[model samples]
Target: MAESLKDKVALVTGAASGIGLATARALIGAGARAVMADRDAAALERLAGELGDAAIPLVTDLLDPDSCAAMIPDALERAGRIDILHCNAGTYIGGDLTETDPAAIDRMLNLNVNAVMKNVHAVIPHMTGRGSGDIIVTCSVAGHFPVPWEPVYSGSKWAITCFVQTMRRQLNKKGIRVGQVSPGPVISALLADWPEENLRKAKESGSLIEPEEISDAILYMLTRPRNVTIRDMIVLPTNFDI
Candidate 1:
């Protein structure tokens, strides 16, 4: 019964490192062969080596429509049907509404929101044709609660949250399951560039949440019985009040 994932195919985005990497690891552990996509080519190669041949690494630029188009067919050709998709690619830019550069906002939206839409758009035809698949989106706590300093980031995440929620409602009857996982701040490469003050504050507030924490949540959603759809899950650091 647990072998439900065995031999199944999964595609994960932003999978060179951090949360995406951890999720890929978990999926592979559960017996699903996976395609890991990311823009970081060198890192992708290293990860593919570590995971061996069961993990296929595809270099991708999520901001490019053509790149998005190219990835799906390649994965399908190599892995056959895509039984699961983990849309985990995202970007964060910090600035108040007035201080934020318009270009930065555009990049954030295009990378964090539009890219996700493009991937789903490209893959949905196949999923719908099969009449079954799982779409797992990596949303964030900031999606549910506004992070004032980073309005655009919040807005982008909120959009993803709403998209998956509504998609879940529409696809539930068609054997397609949409699941959203919202993560609070976690230790990742993104955190390496954090301002010292903010880093200190995060640590002072609580222990850093690891990528494995979020990965475990994703694994749970993917492994549930066919009839059981875990629609949404929010993972917050123990110290975060929200």
Candidate 2:
């Protein structure tokens, strides 16, 4: 039997745009209340407004350990409980290792790796107490395979993949589901910083996927029977070579 999101409350990070935004919208459509969390305050507010009463915006800076720790509690305060947590807030740094800025690398690791751990730490007790919850992470194909152009970004994602797998084992007995969606070249703000030539090449080749495709995969994971967990989903455009 499939699970239903009706009356459930989901907290989604990076909900201002891309896969996060699309997933939040889909959750709302499935009758779940959404807590949209993002650093972009104005965009978060606007999107939440568009989503109406079903959506609540929570401004969060994933770079701050305190802020990441506070997100789950803040969502709980607003919605009473968080049935789902989508740890999707992340930045991408694309370039050869020699050309990448140290600060940019730090920022990527901070958000993609540290923030994920902090957010998970904050939510675990609550979810375990309830004995039922879902944690979905946005990983990347780059995590599974090496990408010369974005080694640091790939490293961050690889860290997340390992984290998710380990946490799944640890939390399975607690009745909490932990899973990750690894997407290949989604057309989102993450790519906005990519080299113009590479971005243009990818676009021209039709290798970029829409954010909605990733959201659809997330919904599938969420709707599966409680006994059936989709541990990892890899979403990519058919035209995508890597």
Candidate 3:
């Protein structure tokens, strides 16, 4: 199974930490080279160094169109080709819509929606030329359900969920697979902005999933037969309530 990914190159955003970082590690372990892109230069550098030659660190700000556009080309220049793109960089805004700052909403939407579209657009041509590729997005359960705690965030995810589904149908004929992994209440920095009491309760109750668990799901999708596509995977903590 490890040999399945041999010689492939994968670009993963938000690779400095959490699910992105775990996915990058798993890809490397599976014998694929990884280009780790993130806004945190120091952390990206450190993790890439730890992962050694198989990992290349690219510091990127996804909020900027230019930066998002450059990610694919930059990875191609370093790794020669990109076989997988993990669009996993995202921010969370947790609060009632009326009380949430407008700027915060923009930040979340731009990164979650705009940046994802830009990155996917940037990689399509390259993947088309190769005649094969995988595009995995990190969507959330909030996308499928109405979560009152994060209405805007949920909206952003819903958009990507639709985008991924539509793109999958459009690109499957081109030998490119587009899919999403929606995890529930992951124990990552993404939840750092959640209400303190809620987060405390989740942790205490052990209802929060870990980053590595999500990474494993990503690997499963990637390692499947080329004839098979895991379109959408919803991963939740075993003890999670919702």
Instruction: Give lDDT per model, in order.
Output: 0.87, 0.93, 0.93
lDDT of each residue in 25-103, candidate 1, tens digit only: 9888888888999999999899889998789988988888788779889889888889999999888876567877898
Tens-place lDDT digits, model 3, residues 1-242: 32298879999999999999999999999999999999999998788779999999998999887887788889999999999999999999988899999999999999999999999999999999999999999999988998988899999999999999999999999999999999999988988899898898898988898899999999999999898999999999887777
Q: How far is candidate 1 from the true structure (C-alpha RMSD, Å)?
A: 1.5
| Weakest ten-residue segment in model 2 by summed lDDT | 62-71
Pitting candidate 1 against candidate 3, the one with the higher lDDT is: 3
Name the top lDDT candidate.
2
lDDT of 2: 0.93
* Candidate 2 Cα errors over 4 Å, as ranges: none
Off by over 4 Å in 3: 1-3
- TM-score head-to-head 1 vs 2, winner: 2
* Candidate scoring better on lDDT of 2 and 3: 2
Candidates' RMSD to native? 1.5, 0.9, 1.2
